[model samples]
Each structure stands twice: as structure tokens, then as C-alpha cells.
Target: MTGQEENGATRKGPTRALVLHPDLKSERRRRAPELALAEAVSLAAALADLAVTGAEVVRLARPQPGMLFGAGKIEELKARIEADEVELVLIDGPVTPVQQRNLEREWKVKLLDRTGLILEIFADRAHTREGVLQVELAALSYQRTRLVRAWTHLERQRGGLGFVGGPGETQIEADRRAIDEEVVKIRRQLAKVVRTRELHRAARRKVPFPIVALVGYTNAGKSTLFNRMTGAEVLAKDMLFATLDPTMRGVLLPSGKKVILSDTVGFISDLPTQLVAAFRATLEEVLEADLILHVRDIAHPETEEQAADVREILESLGVEEEVPVFEVWNKIDLLTLEQRAALLVQDARTPGIHTVSALSGEGLEALLDAISTALDDRRTIETLTLGFEEGRARAWLHEQGVVKAERDGDEGHEMTVALTERQRAQLERLRQG
Candidate 1:
């Protein structure tokens, strides 16, 4: 029922939230604090039915170990929380166990740091089996560190444990042993899923189409662009982590080459090291991709930082440096006429950069052509001779549609074929095996 009220507006009762971002005043910050605070509010809203009642950027010259915010700010915010009847307070940075507990006690409300809020969003969005397992595992890892607080007598505190309950429970299902057991169980199940996925990947290797992966920070229009290109109805919402499961669609590029386009889970800054460790199966899609498209919301103020976060996650996943990647500047339709021209000039000056608005289908032709070129760049024509006994190689060539001409010569069948370096390797492996 959307948790709506009688006036047809969002109900701000228990779901009411105050988004507080502790902006560390640093010269090395990549984005403005206002932009960070706004992103925090967006993230809070992305969680399960959280209606942001208020938001603020709290400048922190230095972090407090016991309580994140000062006593004065805590008391003041407590009054606001009480006046507004806010049920949740989401801090847009890491909060130690002691800090979270103290703040929660002071505010008389639940609290979640950046990682906890993201984990909640992930858990809510995870639908596929592997995705569900990954989310649980990540949440368990986050929960392990947060088993207790300042009030050690309480054992496990309710705040900062990410989402609460299963199908329906009011408080976070937590504790050390519960989290440990859940983590182990999830790992076993995920291992099975990972093996199955490997078999699927092996089967995909037998197919000829190259795999192109779309990766970027959350809500950077990756799924939208994937839908625009592949005509697949993926859940392309304006919310964070809208697409949790990795989705693949067969896309025919402008060059008429069929390729598998994969839309993966979005990356975010400080994306929970546990998530990075647990979601390797989904990240492997990026590793196996013949080309990676770093989609960016060009209209966002933190576009550069978002792109950097995606790159960092990719690197952490051990994505090879040799993989050809294209910087796809998405949402150009949101730009002004002058801004679009500037973007075009910037894109033209870069070798692997393209600008496109996935929503409007603008500059898509050029983007498609770029995809074709990047995939085709690894191709080379070569002549190979296969005996009648080597019908498998001959059939594989025909399957790949890379054979330009084939004729039965005296000694054997000689044919000229065009294929990528990876394709050449695949052919060699087939011949050797």
C-alpha cells in the first residue's frame, strides 16, 4: 500500500528519518559537502520506506570516538527528533559501536551509518538467490563488528545493525553467534551458487558473443541505458541499488555483432568491504567482460567522485587493467544546450569516452558504434586449415560467423576467418583439448 497516509502523501510516522552527514572539513574532499548531504538524503530515502523529514551537513573538524556528534548538537537534534517524531537518524559516515549506541540513547531513536543504510537498501532490493545470499552475508559481516555498544549489559543493541527482522520483525535480528552462523550458512549456499554460476560462465564461453558489463555508482542510469540498448524491461528505478541481481541481455551492436550486455549492482563509496568480498560472483561479470562501460550521471555534481568509486571497486575486484573500458557519460538530456556541447567536446578529446542520454536515445548511435569498435578492436583475420577429422573447429568457426570463405582443399579445408584475440584463444583451447 506504499505506506501512504490519508492525504495521499507519504506517511512520516515510524518511517520518518533525519539524514545527518558528518562532513569532515578536509582539503582532499572530492565533492562539496552539500552534494554529499543531498546524496545521503537520497540514500536514506532509498532504504525501506524511509521518508526523510530533515537533513543537515554537520561539519566535523575531528571525529569523536565515543559519540559522533557533540553533546550540544546531540541534545539539539534530540529535541528536533522529538518535535518531528523522527523514528530514525541516518548518519552519512562511519559510526563506531560506542558512538552509535551513545547517539541512539541520546536521541531516543534508531541510528544507521552509511554502511548500514546501504546494506538495508541492498537487502531490500536483492531478489535473486545469489543476490539474496550476498546481501545476507554482507549484512552479517557488518553485524559482526556491531554486536555490542556502550551498554555492554544489553548484549546486542538494536541500532546500526542494518535492516531488522525477516518477513516481519520490529527490531534487528542480531547477536554474535546468530550472525556467525548465518554468515557460515550463507557462505556454503553462496559457494554452491558460485559453482553453478561458473558452469554457466563456462557455457557462455562456448557461445561466440562478447560480454559487455555496465558498472557505475548507484542510480547512475546504468539499467536505464541497458534497457534502451537491449530493449529489456529491467527494474530501472531512480532509487539506489534498484538492480541488485546481475542481468544480461543479448544486444546487437551497430556493426551487427551480437553481444551479451550485463547490468550489474551499482558501486558506492565505502561499499562495505564485506560486500566487496561477498559479491565477487556478481563482480566476476565485470572481470569476464570483453568491454566495461563506466556509466556516469553527467548531470550529478559528484560525477567524478562517483566514477572514481566505481573504478576503485573494479580494481578491488581485481578486474584486469587490459580490459577495454568506455566512459559513458549518461543523462546528457538533463544538460543544457551549452553543457551538451561542452560534454561533446570533452568526449571527443578522449579516446574511450562517449556521451549519451539513455532516456532520450540521444547520441546512442555513436555510443553503439563505440561499443562495436571496442569489441572489434581485438580482432584479426587469420587463415587456418582443419582436417576432415577436425569438424568441431570448422563447426565452431561457422557458429561464430567469422568465416569469410571456406572450401575443401586437397589436403584439408582451408578457410579465412576473423575473430578477436580472446576468440583466437578459445579456438586454440578447443583445438588443444
Candidate 2:
């Protein structure tokens, strides 16, 4: 709610964003070169939407140990900030404590890098208690490094971390220790959250519903597709990182079998290390899924590249090719007739390929059918032979499996049961007894 009056007219906010692109050649590159710039731009805009009034972009010189950008570029940016009365400068790449402090001093504005911007976004978006805890853990983990530009009234501890000087706590060492203590507290709380989630997962396993995780590049229409499929309104937006947390709901297939559909946080090339680690609990939903629906924005210029990036992330997450996958070429409505026809033909030959417009609900029935068929194929049929003496087992078979027929005999009775593998195993154990 930082605001400034504009010519005594409507009040305006104080935030000013400076979007940056890290030189790919630098050892400090934050993400893949192809996605880094575009992601940075998207994040900057999203940040501005979070109460920032004005925004601008700057290309930083390749990472130098001492300075983030070259001296010449710094001078030019400083002038702009001064003239525009900029209150904040947002860098698209990671900035070391030294770099952040130096930039703030030179530019005379609050400076934040890609990590800070993302952390800020999470801080703003997190509503649930668990979600807030995760975001706080990440923010604290990040802030433990860079702590400069203490607002005018904010105290720098007298005996704490050198970054913050609070009354009677100036020692930077003490501040670091305090921050470390808080980090431990947050971690413990998040660990509890993870355990709670694990219990929920166990409950789901007992019900034995197949899980299909919707995964793709950020802003690749994953949320849109998820809402279309599950009819949940979990924030579908055209902005990057619109959906941070993973969302799960029951999706009934055309055959009337129920499956769990989890819309997970979208993958972005060069995703921040801190974020990946902090959000591991949420992402593991993908790992446990029975199938992965890789929804892609087919019309994006970097669609293929984005797909590769998502694959890399999946690999890192241990979601290997062994898990069933279906590729959903989304946003078909955005394509021209010629391009759409070409993609339709090309994707047709690709296994598990389907086209759909999540926004417009186009071709969704086909996708659902494909999912139902995939689930059916995963179901293994087990044959069972039961003796009449085992009447209890026979009765259980009737409850759990589809019985074909019954043959009666003087000694006992036998029945053929088409049951699932688990049911068959149980029945076999019963027969042996």
C-alpha cells in the first residue's frame, strides 16, 4: 500500500521495477537462456501488478564479482531512477549481498533480484496457514543472505547480524543467529505440514484411485486445463506463477471411474534453487501420480523448448518415462487453421497426443476418453477359483469382483472371479487357508 499523490490527483503507488536479463555466459546465470528473459519479463509484470506503480527493463552486463552491471550501465540506470523517483529496482537474476547493497547505494532505491520478487509474490499470494509457512521458510532462507536498505525507521539490531541493526543488538553475528533460529522453527513447522500431507496421501491410496498430475511450463495453461478438467476455480491466469501451490480434486472420467487430478506448480526453466527446494512437498504430488498430463501451449514461440525444460524438471523430480504420460497440446484456438492442421497431423502420429483448448473447452472429451482408456489399460485382471467350503471368501468375491458363473459339486463349489490383482492375491491366500 505504498502510495504517492500524483499532482494532487489520484494517489499512486511507490514501487518502480527494473527488469533485468542476466548475461547467459556468466557463471551466475539464474535459468536457461531461452526462458530466462521471457520469464523475467513475465515475473516483473506480475510484481508490478502487486502494487508497483511503474516498471522498466534493463539488460545487465555479464556477471562481474563486484558489480552486477557494468559501471556505465549503473550510471545510466542511476540517472533514470533519480529522474523518475523510482522506489525499487528489480533484477531478473540473483544478486549477491554485495551486489544488492552496492546497487542500492548507487541507485538510491530498494533493490531486489529475481528470488526476492518471487518470494514477494508468494508472500502476497499465500493465504492458507500451511502455504504461508512454506513461503515464510523460503523468504527467510533467502533473506539470511542479503539484508540491506533497512527502511528509515527500521532498526538495525545493535548486537545481531551486520545486516540489521536493532536496539542493543548491533553484532551482525547475533542477527544471523536469530535468523537461523527462525529458519529452524519454520522448517520444523513445514515438516509437520509435510507429514500431514503424507497422511492424506495414504488415505487416498486406500481408496485406490489413480492419480493424474497436470504438469507443464509456467503459464502453459496448466491451471486453465486443470479447471476445465476438474471444474475447480483455483486461480487460472495468463501470468507466470499464477498457481504456486499444487491443487488436487477428484476428476470423474467418461466411464464413471474416479481419479485424482493434481494441478501442480508449473515448471520454469532455471527455476530458482530455493524455490525448488522449498516447494518439494508440493511437487512430489507429480512423482506419486499414476499419470502425467503434460499440457503445453502449442502456439508459443518456444513451445518445444518449454517442453524440454519441463522434461528436465520431471527427470530431476524422478518422474521418469516409466510413468504414463499424455501430451496435451493446449491453446489450439490460438493457432491458425494451417498451423493447427499441421500440429494436429504431427501430434496424431505422436503417442498419447491430444489437442485441446483449455480456455474454450475444445476437444476436452477426447482428452477425457484418452485418460479413461489409459486407466483401463493400467487395470490388471486376475482370475480366481474358489471352493464352496470357503463361503466367506466366496461372498467377499461377489462383493469385490465380477463373478462370471458358479459350478456346484457334491464336495464343494467353484466360482470364476474376474478380480483385480490385489483382490486375486487376497483370494488366493484365502483359498490356501
Candidate 3:
């Protein structure tokens, strides 16, 4: 029987879900409970076949060990769940295995914590082989810690990693050894994917175009901006994690200079550590970026906090300090006229900030001009004299199209080339060898 079937009755339509955000007073760096709950509802909406019935913030002085909520509170939630016929409860916080088990028994419904929900979204959205493997690896790592005996029947009924619910056959409980073996297999598959990606990167490096990567909080308009700039139909939506895998497209700037633009997965506050580690390889585009555009949803209530989260993740990824970063304040179309005017004034005063509404194309001309100018600043024209023996270096300079002028010389040739810092370094290495 499918997971939707209960007591011989096949459930119809989307699974009714209730989202709860546990507001712990003792926790540091706490977000507004209402906002957290709202985000959770949005997250629930991101998953297909999950209709959120109700959502609220549950205040707690402290958490109960066995059941995240106190006995009385648990009973209260159970009554509400029964009344609403909620088949699934999504907790916007971590829940231990014991706590999850107890809550499932008490509430008589499937429960997923924030991490599980995020994994489900990723699994559902991940279209690439690398992305799928990474999600599976992260899910396996998470499941290894919370595996329950005789829960294989539950595993078969979910669309993604079997966390929520789908259709499949009943299976045996997954032992730790079995989980470990699966992990190994996924890692092997992922290594192959990474190698292929590395080859692609190497090919891009040969093209000599600067890589500009867009990164920001989820639903912060990175993909929208990318589509507006590159004219590519990448999925740009209001949902969280609309674009999971990294996408790259070549764009010709108004200055007639070409560049590769990369749109990456958006960052969120308190992202699961397992995913952070697992998706590191996926974010290598940012590492190789010549410039990073930190897109911000200026209209979001927690815009500053969201920007902070993106910076934190970028730092963790060890992006080079030398790579130039420009802040793109997006979504001005959602702001009031007065607010938008004020933002534009502030943006003018900021050295590395640009304001735009990717949806409405407001201020995009200026943003694109700024991008072209920023890329130009990375390059410098230098006159160099190469010996006859350095034929390879001369060929490379011509191939890069950095050679602005060249003249025959007594030894070999003298050339004037406009080269970016990376190109200059490569030229020097060639000369040294």
C-alpha cells in the first residue's frame, strides 16, 4: 500500500500539513517566531502535494527531551491535528530521533524537521545527476542518525528520499552498515560528476571570459536578474530554492565585452550543515568567479539578516578575498515609490552597490554598465617582449585575444596586451616554464 493509504483507505489529493515553529527563549540569534513560521509555510508550499492547513508559532520555555513539546502542549497539538486531519506536521527546528519517534506516535502523523523538509525540496528540484547524488548523500547521512527499526515501509512512499510520501514497495529497515554502503556508492558517483564538472570548468578557463557569479538568499531574485541579463529561461520563481543546481550562460554586455554569468543556489539562515558540506562541490563556480554579485531582496523584511547569511556561507566556502564583490539590491519594484527613491540615493552613495528590479528592468542599464566597468578594471594593457623560443606563450596571448598590438622585434616579437590579473599570471607561468 502507498504511504497515502491508511487503514485501507487511499488518501486523495494533497497531504494536509501543519507547520509549527518552536520559539525557544533560551536560543541565541533567534528570528521572529512569526517570520520563521511564515518561512516554514513557504517552504511547505515549495514541496508538491503538501497543502498547509494551518501554521503557528509554539512558544516554549525549554524543550522536552523525548517529545520536543511538553506533555500538555503535545496533547494540545494532537487535538488540533486531529481536528484539522493534518497528516503531516512540519517543525521549523531540529528534532532528535527519539523526539521524532515519540511525536509521530503521539500525533499519529508523519513529522519532518526543517532539515528534512529542505532535503525534500532539494531532492524534488534537483534535476542534474550531481545534484541528485548530493541530495541522496545528504539524506543518507541524515537518515543514518535517525533510522528507526521497521520504518522501511515509510521510506518507500515519498517523492524525495522518501521523507515525505510517494509510492513504492515496502522494504526492510536500513541498517547502519547498509546506509554506509549507500553513502559510499553515492560518493563514488559524485566523484565522477565532480570530475566532469572540473573538465567543463577547465574548458571555460580556456575561453578567457570573466566569470560573474550571482549569489544571494533564496528567492532573492538572482535567477530573475540572470534571466534579465542573459536572456535565458532558467526557472525564476517566488518559491524558496526554485533553482537548486548551478546554471551558467554566456552574456554579451552592452560594451561588446562577453562574460559568463552563473546563477547559484540561494543561501538561507541556519542551512543544514550536511547540505553545506555536500553542496560545496556544486558551488565551485563561485570560487572560480572573477566577480561575485551579492543579490539582495531589498523588499524582504529580513533583508539585512539574509545578506549576512549569504556572506557567512560565502566565507565558509573560502572564496578568495581578492575577488571583487558587488552588492545588487534587487526587488525595488516591490518597494514604495518613496522607499525606492531613498534606496536609489543610498545606492549612489555606496561604492559597490547597484539597485535594480530584475522583474521590471529598473536600473538594469546602470547595473550592466557597472558590471562591464568592473570587469574592465580587472584588466591592464602591458607591453611585453618575448624571445623566439617563447612561441607557446605568444600563441596563448593571441588565443586569449588579449593582444592589442604586436610588432616584429630583433629577438622575436614585442606585443601590447590587455590582460586580466589571471591571464597575466598565466602568461608569467608560461614564460617561467
lDDT by residue (tens digit), candidate 1, 1-433: 1232347775634477888988886536877888888888888877755678999988877787789777788788889999998877888888887787778778867788888788777777888889888877777677667755321212322222334221222233445656567668878998898899988876776687888999999999999999999999999989888888999999888798999999999988777787888788877889878889999999998898899898888888988766788999999989999999998999999899999999999989999988898787787888888888888988878866678888999878999998876667778889888
After superposition, candidate 1 runs with Cα above 4 Å error: 1-14, 149-174, 382-433
Which residue pairs clash within candidate 3? 157-165, 157-166, 158-165, 158-166
lDDT scores in order: 0.80, 0.71, 0.87
> Per-residue error at 421 for model 2, in Å?
12
Please, what is the TM-score per model? 0.83, 0.79, 0.89
lDDT by residue for model 3 (1-433), tens: 1237668987678889999999998897546788888888999999988899999899999999989899898889999999999999999999998898788888878889999899989988999999989988888888777865222423555557676654322233536767778879888888898999878876666687888999999999999999999899999999999999999999999999899999999899889999999999889999878889999999999898889899999999998677889999999989998998898899989999999999999989998899899889889988999998899999888777678899989988999998877677678889999
Q: Candidate 1 has what TM-score?
A: 0.83
Give the poorly placed runs of model 2, Cα more than 4 Å off.
Answer: 4-14, 24-35, 48-61, 147-171, 382-433
> lDDT value for candidate 2?
0.71
For model 1, the run of ten residues with the poorest summed lDDT: 150-159
lDDT of 2 by residue, 1-433 (tens): 2343468874554355555565645365434555566667677665433333344444544566677778888888788777866666767767888888788778866666777777766655566567778777776677666544332112422111212111222346665677688889878888888889878776665566677899998889999988888888899889877887778899899899888999877787667777777777778878777788999999988888889988988888776455778999999999999999998898778879999999999889988988998877765644445556689877765654356677876666656644443345556677778
